[model samples]
Target: MLRETWAEIDPGRIVDNLRAIRGTLPAGVKLMAVVKANGYGHGDLEAAEAARQAGADYLAVAFLEEALRLRAGGVTLPILILTPIRPDQAELAASQELTLTVTDAAWFRELRKGRPAPAPGGRKLRVHVKADTGLGRIGFRTEAEWDALVPWLAAPDIDVDGFYTHFATAGQADTAYLERQACRFAELMERCKASGIAVRHYHCAGSAAALRFPGLALDMVRIGAAMYGYYPPQLTPPVQLKPALSLHSTLMQVKRVRRGEYLGYDNAYRSDADEWIGTVPIGYADGWSQRMRGADVLVRGRRAQVVGKISMDQLMIRLPGPCAPGDRVTLIGRQGGERITFAELAVHIDGAAQEISTALTDRVHRICANEKEVQCPWSSPYFQPHRREATVI
Candidate 1:
């Protein structure tokens, strides 16, 4: 039988998380669920549809390709690209009705120069102006730059709709820098007013800001991590967002190691005594980290410590005798009464969650929580006509 490993996404959990987000925010604050990076390692199309159905007003992605994937998947709701898109991709962005992020006048000019025609039903290419303020990464550095971009953004061809900024320290207890960044954003908004730009939607709060400062919630709040059931260490979760991912792998085999037996590359871990070893068919290739060699994974509702090195395609674990081949190992999400967290994995792996997402290989099979078998968006219609017929809406 084909086995599944690593992340498995729960579309039902996505719906529940969106409900939690809706409950936390005030009636006026629109929720923009960030579904980028493949919905933070969860599948994107399902995540987007679930989020939209759960009352999310918008979706936020990191790149144009991701946005395009969602669009191609029949997601008709609004999606905002977080990163500055290359001007070369503007036509596809326009045709697909994906929102573009313009950080400066030059960036706006580049995108607005040769955009595609308005889609049949969708509006012209809509864009949101991002203010760098104090984030120091993307967006206009000063109020003047924002002011200069207003007139062009408000042009007839460009559907300039909103203004947003990022917060560097919104989750901290201090809230001092967040306040300063908010102030700077406010000043820039004022400058846009002076330039006669009609701002349709004004936002600056992210997930942290939405939880930390209720008053700062503007027309929209960009929620990324909170949608994944993770809030900052200090800040409380705005709502009861359950994590939407679970990773599982079956034990490939079992072995008994005598005392002083060494395991794995470089002989990283040695057996202290006669130990029952369980080998899981997962590794760093499946998003498990080598740094997590000593981390506990749930097997048969019991904790088993991972032994020695995490090989490219497999990992050895120390189980308490009873674990055998075909035993399920839970990595991300709950097993029995215990919960394994990505944050915990990050600490053990000496890597960030974003890095973990990028490092995941293609071995992990995605099992949708709702068991959706929707046709792949990337599949061509010519090939589709020859396949078996089934129940499809």
Candidate 2:
């Protein structure tokens, strides 16, 4: 690819991680791979393919557009859109054989009002009813609200394929809130059963819940972060996961800064002595935040500290010795027997690995090493040169 700075995606690792997560589920439990947000910024179609090959029973995305993209890409697995779809988009979603989520009964009625009649011979619109046990975001918040929607869910026009909920604290050590949410969800499921509503799937576990509370893995578990080799710090995964994505870049330039010379914008760093500095072609725009200035990156297996203020498209690192342009740099991955993880970077930025992965911008090329394909968002064709140099300031 053209840019030396790109994300290397290991689909094999994703497959292994999916298998690992699958092993934790009980007999007959299904796995729903969450490939929304571009597969957690690892490339949606690639990750989805890997997960499916590794035995994912279903695929889920955040919106109808994502589901349609997967359909266009020839993905035949049952696809569910987790977020609520617009009333205008309902007919199109159904026509594409996509599953939509219903958060509130009133909203569902409104969605059907303007929704065009289903196409002749088209598949029924599958739907999953979400209950807001305690997340307080979307879904039916009270029992009366959820009960009112059950009868309508069984309408001939719609297929009530699933029922689900979300846990707000499944990853935390405290189980009080988690237990409460689970109890509420259980009560709702019991109500559904008593009302003779057949839900083909019942799920309440995301990555954290799947790992921390495997018992909550009812009919399926929506696997996301765990499939990418990360878990909440407070929770331990039953199976080991391999990181599927790594951020890498080449040393654009190397120069020596005189003692007392300033580095980067605002002169945020001053050299105490003549020091070697290496510039990398990545910055805040690439999801490498300015708050990561003090974080350490792997340079030839040695630790190099980010010294200067991170700019929009570049950042400076203090090198141990003279390093030349074209040297390999590891921003979030293993290199030369050393490793930098998203969790470590999260500690520096006070965020989670999911946040770090999803924050990656489209400008960065996604190189699927296993597939031997390069996914580029830039308009320019892929360019490659044996060697290239950047201007040294």
Candidate 3:
């Protein structure tokens, strides 16, 4: 089945973005590509593979399941789980050789009690201690809390692989808060070092910090949005990034609307004059939100305004002129001389480009394009396209 709506992922573009980011890093600084949220909705396995090929030293995800998915997909790089895992999940995570993050000392004690014994001839579970600094979401918030974890760090059942922290305002123009967070993290690191608890990888820089404040790129950096060609609006990336994902769909129907005719649900839009209208087989269910009613989509390489309330599986676009079904529509990519960027879409939703990309639903097929050819699940032998002419709905 040839799906009308799909997201095209360019691995080459991802590699380019990774390379660009790496180019800006100081020598010996490692890049840990963050592939959480299904690689920001770009397909985790595909994105991780591309990042690995581009020389990412590590890969990070937010959950144990994501790390397991990567391992199952043959990802051999060091995979770190950024989020804390339950005591019950610690053994399974360790069994898969996934690096787990430790936040609270008491929680660590509980995990240690429930954690399964190490496998035969297997190494101890690798762990990274997280310092909360100022994020206030997770990790040890003070020296006392961190000191409480020192015994667990020295336990024979676990190996302390790293220590890290997160920044709350690394991407903003105002660096006061970010500086304070950095200072706190530094103080914690010094305390750890003085206490003879040191790890190889000491990192705090995420994508924003890595790009804006290279000094914070201690041992490694966790890069997410910038690796996918996006950054917060307030900060400028040090290197150019090539977007790896492009959303596209085919027009399913085309019709002539008479003057004063209402379109879509609730009769939200009324045509002021007889005009060409197109129905695209994509809508809120596919991550196109209802708030995008006034946004523009590319039709035949020309901009066409979204005309009415977005539906569950379809939406109406005001075409420039008479058009037929099966015409190509570009939602987030280049179309002839025009382009609809993630930044522009973010403006419509008043969110970051990262949110826009990650919000894309799974109903949309992910077609990965590389130097070889386009690979899609729909291309397999089991899939057969139905022969039917496009018709008005």
Candidate 4:
């Protein structure tokens, strides 16, 4: 990569994570690998390929555009779009054989009016019914809403592929809310069965729920964050998953500063004593925002505190001692015995680990750890330097 800062993605690690999660699942439980938000910023295509290699039964994205991109990348696994699409976009999604998430009966009415033409082989538009047991986000909330949607789902042109819900407190210390939601979903499933709607799959557990409560893996389990090693350990997950992404950079410039002197913009930091300061070529523009000012990074296996206001393209760190200009810097990974985790960084910003991983922008190039084995599918000039030409998002 041309940039001094880069993120390394290990496809093998993802594969291992998937396998570990799979080991905890019961037989005949399908695994749907969620690659939404660019695989939580680990690179969607790479994650999907890794999932496929590990025998994932299906793939899921948040929008139609994401599913279409995966199809263009030659991913043939059945892809389900988790978020509902515009009624007008139904045809395009159907044309690509993409499954869509349907929440409201009104949406189905709109879709039926602008009906997508039948496929060449009599293929029906596949759909998953989203039920809101809790979280109060999107989905049919009551039995009345489900009843209203039943007739529309019976249409000859559509297929009810799955029925699912999301748990808001799956990762929380309290399981009371999660149990209530699960019970509510169970009631809906029984109602669905009695309705004879012929729903093919039933799922409720996401990564945390699936790992913490295997019984929730009804017909399938949707593994997303945990597949990339981002789940909370407080859940005491049955399987162990390693992070597939790590960030690294080099110390571009290092200099000695006096205690009275200030560093960075607006004199954001003043050295308490004569200290060695090092500059790293990564800042907010690279997804390392100003809130990271007080964070610590690994410099030659030693912890160096970020001592100044992070700029758009660079950040300064208080070195443990005098360090060379070209010394390696570990931002979110292991160096000697020290390691910086996304969870640790997220704690500094009062957020989740996902916020840290997904915040990394495309400006920070990703170097695949095992490029030869699990080739990156992003089509960008930056990856052309590798043995095989590839791209990025």
Candidate 5:
């Protein structure tokens, strides 16, 4: 890429992670690879292909557009839209043979008004009913809501593909809330049985919950963060997953600052003593916001604290010693024995590992480390120069 900042992704690691999680699952339990948010900013098509290589049974995206993008990219695996779509959009979703998430009966009623024409080969409009057992986001909450939705789901024009819920405390130390949500989901499953609504797949656990509690893996598990190797170890998961994404950049400039001198806007940082300072070509606009002021990167395999309020396109870091403008900077990866992880950055930002990765803007280029294993989707005339060999984003 023309820029010095870039993210290196190893699609092979994603494949390995899915395989590791699969080995821990019971036989016959399907794995739904969640590649929403452009595969959490590691490139959606790349993540989907990796999931396919690892034998994933299904793929899931957050919305209709994401599913359509995947289809355009030639991803044919059964794709489920995790978020509910507008009723008017049903036809488009149906035409693409994409499974949609539904919350209430009213949505179904509206969808039926303009029933989507059968897709190529007469494929039914597949859907997954989401129950709000917890998390308090987009789902039918009570039995009344489910009862109202039952009749619409029974229509022959629709296919009850799956039933699922999201857990809010899956990665937390406390299990009380998670257990409560699990119990509620079980109640909903029983309600489905009583209503004669057969669902092809029944899933509740996300990556953290799935790895921490295998017994809860009813018919399938939606693996997202764990598949990308960002799940926290505190959950005591059975498998080990390695991160597939790492950030790297070159120091654009370096100089010495006197103890009394200040740097950055409004003097957000002041030199404690005569020290070497380096400017990195990444900042808030590039997803490294001011909240990362206290965060650190690695220079020459040594820790360097980010100093001052991060600018829109640049950030300053206190160097260990004198460093050249072309020296490598490790933002989210290993440098010798020292390493900077997403978890560490998350602590500073008070968010999840995904919040850090997903926040990464497209301005920072991406390079696939093992392009030989998974062909880069952007290898076309549009991305020019070294088309056959270069995998850039």
Candidate 6:
């Protein structure tokens, strides 16, 4: 039998985060759960369903494929594609009734190609206006660009439902720059209001805004990390939200290492004392970053140091106690009344620099935690937790 080295997705913890987020939202504001990066590297199906059930008004993903997977999995709630959809996928976007981002009029014209003149059934496709703001990403850079597309947005086929921009530094404490950016955004929104934009929602904040600057929440918020139980660098984490994903693996071996003995590639680490050297089955291929070489993990309620370079299939860790194989290693999540988070891991790699999910891959399996700890669903329902909402995929 293959040893289970998988991710445990805790839906109940996600539910708790949503409830806390809802409490923080204003009276008329709604939460748009960001399920992008495959729910921030936690499985999408589980994250989306949990967020939807916990009262999120909508779910947001990065692209058409991500949204499609959710729809195919029978997710019923509204999904917003935060990124621009490819021209070829516009019809698919139209068919699924997904809200898409329009950065320019060229993409808009492409969406009109195979689409009916009046739009089939006279139903409108939800559309959101994307402004570059300060992120300098894929969005209309100027008011002139938005002005050129105003008329087409009024067309019967497109429903210009919202206007949004990304926050570049709202996560920082005393974000004066973001404050000034928000003022500028206010001016732009005023201009849109003067020009009769008729936007259904106006938002400029994302995960950072959801936690750090609540006043900027506006009509709604697009959140990801915080919903996954992490806050910005500046904000204090509340007690209500708990991390939903925990990565655990069994210790493969524990052997005594002599002083001056080399470990791993290039003798990256040498044991200073005649102590226990342990191996964890997970490695860089499993998203245990190379920078996490000196990182810490909880083994048997005590912190164990990751020594040497992480290989594709294995990694060496230094143990402080008389440890044995089959003991659990906590990579991301709480253990022994203590918690370790992905954000902390990211800090070890690059503080406030790298996107944590970018390093994670889909190779690892996702199994429900607690319910069936004895069995992993590599070939069973523990892995096939598909909920149906749409009759046809």
Writing each residue's lDDT as its tens digit, candidate 2 over 1-393 gives: 667887777777888889888888899999999999888998777777888788999999998888988888778899999999886788798778889999777766776677545455556778998989999888888778877887677666778899999899887888999999999999989987887877899999999888877789999999988899988765667788778778888899999989999999999999999999999999999888888899998788788999989999999999989888999888888876788888888778888898998998877877655532323222212212121221110
Model 4 steric clash pairs: 378-391, 378-392, 379-391, 379-392, 380-391
| Deviation of model 1 at 257, angstroms | 1.0
The local lDDT score (0 to 100) that residue 211 gets in candidate 2 is: 80
User: Per model, how many backbone clashes are there?
Assistant: 0, 0, 0, 5, 0, 1
RMSD of each: 5.2, 4.5, 4.4, 3.1, 2.9, 5.2
- Give a tens-digit lDDT track for model 3, residues 241-318: 878788889899999989999998999999999999999999898888897789888987899999989999999999
TM-score of each: 0.87, 0.91, 0.91, 0.94, 0.94, 0.90
Weakest 10 consecutive residues, lDDT, candidate 6? 384-393
- Name the TM-score of candidate 6: 0.90
TM-score of 5: 0.94
Badly placed stretches (over 4 Å) of model 4 are: 116-121, 378-393
Per-residue lDDT over 1-393 for candidate 1, one digit per residue giving the tens place of the 0 to 100 score: 155464555566667766776677777888898988777776677667777777888899999888888887788888899898888787778788788888877765665566544345545668888888798988888766766776677666777778889999886789788889999888887887777766677889887788767788878888887776666544567566666566778888888889999999999999989999988888886766677788888887778889888998889888867666787788766676777776677667765544555455556765544433433332322111222222110
The TM-score of predicted model 3 comes to 0.91
Candidate 3, residue 187: the lDDT equals 95
Name model 3 segments beyond 4 Å from true.
115-122, 371-393
Clashing pairs in 1: none
**In order, what lDDT does every prediction score?**
0.73, 0.82, 0.83, 0.87, 0.87, 0.75
Q: What's the distance in Å from true for residue 265, model 5?
A: 0.9
lDDT-better candidate, 1 vs 3: 3
State the lDDT of candidate 6 residue by residue for 243-352, as single tens digits.
66677787999999889999999888988888798899887787766878888888887888899999998898899788988988877766767666767776787654
Q: How accurate is candidate 2 locally (lDDT)?
A: 0.82
Please say which candidate is ahead in TM-score: 1 or 4. Answer: 4
Write down the lDDT that model 3 would get.
0.83
Q: Which stretches of candidate 2 lie over 4 Å from their true place?
A: 115-123, 371-393
Model 1: how far residue 21 lies from native, Å: 1.4
